[model samples]
Target: MLGFINGFLRRRQRERLRVAEFSSYWLEILKTNVPLFNRLHSADQEELRWRVQVFLAEKQFEGCGGLTITDEMTVTIAGHACLLLLHRETDFYPELYSILVYPSSFLVPVKRDFDDAPGIVHEGVDVLCGEAWPTGAIVLSWDEVCQAFSDDRDGTNVTLHEFAHLLDMEGGEADGTPILQDHEHYREWAKVFETEFTHLRRARRRGRLTVLDEYGAEHPAEFFAVATEAFFENSSVMKQQHPALYGELKGYYQQDPIMWLSRSDPVK
Candidate 1:
């Protein structure tokens, strides 16, 4: 009973936030920084705006490494992150609460055991532009976020990449699979992703240029994130090169970005 009450109250709060007055300044920031925003249809653009409003209202943003958070930064990041939520029944990344932003790439300590070594573990720091924590925070580099949003077609979006991890983590662990809409869809999803994942690994081994980046071959979770970047940013080429993969993403996301691109006016 208490759980239901809490859920209802949260929904009411979010409904108010969704209909709250959105600042023209934030809208302009999205217009100027997020190229994908200009490509969306009018209806989708409005949906995105509502999602962003709720997103910014519910989530916390903090600056790190001598950086200061601003409306422009929050709006742009929320705009891109909410792109993943469009046209879907979402909890707005229920596990995520805080977003930590850095001015540029940051180094994170890493520790991993060699697959063949029994007791030896290697420890090091990795240079990362973004990361999604299972502990309820997503970290991003502000510069990389701007770069990805500026190009909007290079299939390299740190924001999308990390947020994709968050989506995968919603399934309880990040193994490349996200919570699907139906129980039966999991069978098809597994088949399609397995086939494509194998294809990408082979293509990387052969040093062949592919629409999905080679980095996707690293792991299933990374592949999902990379594929998401390509889904929104390089939709046309992805549709052409990996039709099955594109179809699954299209169905999962419930948005055809290619159609959006084809039907929309030139991006400003």
Candidate 2:
């Protein structure tokens, strides 16, 4: 009798916790790229909110200086970051617990070179709004993130770009690959990525325009990151330009944004 009573109390407690956790709607997840806000299906939006709540329970956020980081701010960041993980199970570095944010533009060190240069010297610091290194360090400028959410340009989303880098780095190397499930997946991935990478490189060399950014031609990793951005934000264009690549991304991400676009006339 006592065992039955304890089990019932435990189940009740779990239910109560779930209800309390999801009762709030004004979560930071809502402050996303306006397009993402309008494009997500109702179910996805609810899922995002739930993920944000759970995410908030897991991650660590540090507001450098005396800056105040609200639940809204943390949720806003995590919500978008979670979008990359929505379709798959990704265990990003458990060390990736800290998120460093600045009030505005921050100075980060970088390498630069003049003409006739294969290698660059550590010239000075770069005035960047955001940067993400594969070792679980992410730097953000709050101002730039806000502006990026509002900007309608297809060319960029700093947070998305940086987070995409993290995804690409989940594999042994940050060489534009996350972990794949099987050998068959790896074989297919290699074929698709190499073919697509070659195509983009040729396009950039020939001065041909691409749906994804030409900066992708810089390296294998950049190609993957840029392809990811196009896959999510400008999905139809990605589909129109590279059907195979789009199909592969759809397979990996499970969510077809092209379908989302077609379903909602207001989103496009």
Candidate 3:
């Protein structure tokens, strides 16, 4: 009963925040920074606005690497993040409460084990644009975010890539599997993802170009995130080149970007 009461209270609070009017200034920020926002249907645009408002209200933003967080930065990040939740019923990333932003790619320390040595490891630094922790925070580079919007169809958005990790992590692990509606769906998801992942790995080994990025070959979690970036940014190409993968993503995201794009550009 106590747990239920807390959940209920939280839901009410979220609802109140959702109902609060979003300022026109933030709306303009989204319009100016995010080209994808202008492509969404009117209804979806309205829904996204509410979701962004709730997200901005719920999640805390902090600046790093001499970057100062601003309303434009907050709205731009939240707007893209909220795009994933547009067609779904969600608690708005229940495990995420904070976002950390950097001016550009940030360096993170990494330790790698040597294959020849039994337990010896080498420490190094990796420059990364974004990262999402399982149940805590998301870190991103503001420059990358701006570049993603400017590129628009490059199938690379640091924001979407990291948030996809958050979605995959919802099942308590980030092994590329997210919570599905049923057992049958899970079976199909596993089958399709495995097949595509293997195919991409093989393609990379052979030095062949593929619709999905080669970075997806790194891990299953990365595959899902990279595929998500492609699913939204290069939907038409994905639908044409990898129909099965596109179908599954369409089912999961509950939106048809191909159709949306066609509607937006009927001429071609």
TM-score of each: 0.96, 0.80, 0.95
Q: Which lDDT tens digits does candidate 2 get at residues 9-112?
A: 75565345444555344442463444575567777766666555555665678786566887666766776777766646654334476788888888877677
Error of 1 at 97 (Å): 1.0
Cα lDDT of model 1 by residue, 1-268, tens digit: 9999989998998888767887899889989888888888778888899999899878999999999999999999999889999999999999999999999999999998997997898999999999999999999999999888878889889999999999999987899999999999999989999999999999999999888989999999999999999999999999999899999999999999897678556543
lDDT of each: 0.91, 0.72, 0.89
Residue pairs in candidate 1 whose N, alpha carbon or C atoms collide under 3 angstroms: none
| The 10-residue segment with the lowest total lDDT in model 1 | 259-268
Candidate 1 structure, TM-score to reference? 0.96
Best by lDDT: 1
| lDDT, residue 182, candidate 2 | 61
Candidate 2 clashing pairs, residues 3+ apart or interchain: none
> Which residue window of length 10 is worst by lDDT in model 2?
23-32
